[model samples]
Target: MGSTILPTGMVFASEQNITENSSYSSSDNVGVSIQKDENGDLMVVKTETKARANVARWGAWQYTHIALSTGVTAGAINTAYSKGIGSVLGIFGLPGWAIGNLLTAAGWTNYGNSPGNAVARLWDKNHNGWVGFYKRTGYDGAGRAVATAYKTE
Candidate 1:
């Protein structure tokens, strides 16, 4: 576990693999401490945020596509969401997409959602014809967006 000091004197682990902003998810069991009295009395405040209850974060976004009509590319997904396919399969919305386009998954916390219905494809190094946007339902500790890529139209 890694650690950092926030301006308010809070602490967090670097293990979240998040940078550019300091943050932790609700699902992450983190604690913040406050001095109850100047005499050194202290209390621990725990914060937690779980992913959507209906879908498991680990089973949300796994995909590697060759193109529409063809099918999933063989090695794409394993290389993409390396966190494990089962953990990413259905976290976004449906089970699958049209036969042509493919969903691309990356580090969920790496990029921020673009402004106003913008498809964040520009930030994706492996970007294809990514287009057609959806509400970015995910965020990191800094409240930066972690959008879901559901189409490439």
Candidate 2:
């Protein structure tokens, strides 16, 4: 008698295989897979995605001078000069000149000398002292006054 061989149910099944008792599936998809390990724990696979970038904008400060008479208190100087200058600029849709006056009044420049004095000496005909205005040019790196002008003197 001659021995004979026979092929099983599925010839070359890539995903699943069928046996007489049980069946198994590959459970793998491209690089991703959904499968259980010997411990029967689920596992997931992922691919790298593009990262997002962030951006920021830069701005500059603007300043104007306020002129005042001598012997003016910093507060008074700020009120009279700063407010007036601010109001005038506001009319033209410009930023308040108060910031410049405040900075000058606060002694941020010239050893904290009265901004009023600087303005007065520079432009006041009576030399009675006045407030000065300065605007930042371009992006003020130090955030300080770049140029200054007086109310008329």
Using lDDT as the measure, the top candidate is 2
Task: Please tell me which predicted candidate would have the highest TM-score against the true structure.
Answer: 2
Provide the TM-score for each candidate, comma-separated: 0.19, 0.21
lDDT, candidate 2, at 135: 29
Residues 28-122 of candidate 1 have per-residue lDDT tens digits of 32332111212221112222223222212211323433232111232323222343333433432332321101222122223333121122332
Instruction: List candidate 1 stretches off by more than 4 Å.
Output: 1-17, 20-23, 27-119, 131-153
Predictions in order: lDDT: 0.27, 0.29
Q: How many clashes show up per model? A: 14, 15
Candidate 2, after superposition: displacement of residue 126 in Å? Answer: 15
Candidate 1, overall lDDT?
A: 0.27
Q: Mark the 10 consecutive residues where model 2 has the least summed lDDT.
A: 1-10
